[model samples]
Target: MSKNKVHYLKKLEIISKINTQGLTVRSVSHDYNISVSTIKDWLRLYDSFGISGLVPGTSIKYPNEIKMKAIEDILVNHLSKADVLKKYKITQNSVLNHWIKRYNNDKTLKQRGVGVRKMNKGRITTFIERIAIVKEIIASDFNYQALSEQSGVSYQQSYSWTQKYKAHGEQGLQDRRGKSRSSDQQLTETEQLKIENKALKAKNELLEIENQLAKKLLEFEKDVTRSL
Candidate 1:
């Protein structure tokens, strides 16, 4: 809270203690008076971006194709979040979370630009406004287009925010554009089933939504033709 940025060496020192000494992140947080999340971010950034990831205000741009493929891996190929992080060399967990947010809600992967300030796709919205929009979207059974149009926010922003709120509550909406590679753990059968089921459910929902929209479009076209 006191320092806006911690030096890379200092960040490295803290991370080293955890990695080498096996010190708990909590202990390091208490000793350094830094939040546990901040320390965790540094550890991940170090793993992914090395020293540069630990640097304050470091912005890494991910290409759109890379983002889309990563999303497909997560949603369709059933890759774990941690695995996707390593595979893509994504700088922060938050970056992937942001991408997942868009994918889950909209059922589409939109192109994302790079940079800390301008990376997000939509126009600016306040925390309070996001909460309101998210709540409305949930109430409408996640009708992102309706809520986005009503709120004058882009559909992508509405979908992204709503997805986060649904998954992590209000805290998820906070711009956490924040990463690490630990040893990969083997999944049990039950865990494997859960991952597959989740992906299947997402795919099913997407298809259902698309079908309903297509039907409505066809009906509208028919009505227009008859009236003319």
Candidate 2:
């Protein structure tokens, strides 16, 4: 037992002796080197419920391990909130509130901070120049890390820029922060439609080439069969 526990047990034993032997509180406190008020308090507890009441009243609010385990099981196993609460000895509302708060904070953190550097005209222009250099390096069959080193951009940033460029084209290179709808002067509707149509036509031509190659292969097989 801890020193505190030993002290508590000694106090209880002293109080028990005073109660049974009818020893005075002042005399017992002086002999035991304990306070008189402390002896009085112990005797009061002893009188109230005998030996059990002499033990310290537990005021510590220990968290329920079963409830914590239940929460863990619910999260790890994807169990329903009601089932988790029932298994863990916690209220349904407590479990729901805890998870909802956790999910909301996680989502808020994602939306609030992305850890990317703030963009400006200087940064945007530098990024555009680097992007051009990266494209040139890629055409020459340089790897992503080599392009990153050549462009003075991290590999992850270079990869992210490549994806953004693919998704939004040249406009993606422009700084978007603090910009409004008025700043967005993209290609006209007719121009966008024309570009899309041209891309579709290119895709169709590639597919046609592949189909012709397949037919040529079949014809070559037929000629070989005749020769055999």
Candidate 3:
């Protein structure tokens, strides 16, 4: 599996959650900290090719004529992107977007080669870098794929770090295995403040979720009272 790519098995799990468990794309996105667009892409791909569609580098290489036709259906016939994807079985919008850009620019329709694309392997990162990437993931609305590419780490790495940060605070991001207690316990004032701040953020987020649930519960109770 490529470092930057999400594994097909994980994609299948997400698809199952949405399809079999009756979860909405947005809810799955929130729970998994992935982008809604990315989830939608996976759903469309799975719809077209089942588990195989979710596999990285399995997309079909369309002829130039097909590309032009798909683009025309969108640009001239006013088809929705989703509709076009279904019609053509294209797995990703990014590919069609590229074709659209070229067609609009009056470029010639040329068939591109098909095959797996080469991506750089994920690189190791320090503790500080992990913290920065996790912060960026939160700031970007939990777009883990984008952060993974930007941070030169695997999607798994970015997602795991964020999960740990949420579940265990700053200490979760540290790789203290095989280290002595003295070094692990040592922390500068600023780093200590960061740990405190991250914990508070996690607590505040929990509070926000609880507050929303409480409001919904109150609404339900009011409806029950009115009915009685």
- TM-score against truth, every candidate: 0.38, 0.25, 0.42
Candidate 1: tens digits of C-alpha lDDT, residues 66-144: 7766777887789988778878888777799998788656533442322111233367765556766676666555655
Provide the lDDT at 150 for model 3.
68
Candidate RMSDs in Å, in order, are: 23.9, 29.0, 17.8
Residue pairs clashing, model 3: none
Clashes of 1: 2
Question: How much is 172 displaced in model 1, in angstroms?
Answer: 48
Pairs of residues clashing in candidate 1: 44-179, 92-178
Q: What is the per-residue lDDT of model 2 for residues 59-85, given as tens digits with 9 covering 90 to 100?
A: 212132243344456655788765554
| Model 1 accuracy (lDDT, Cα) | 0.67
TM value for model 1? 0.38
Error of 2 at 30 (Å): 99
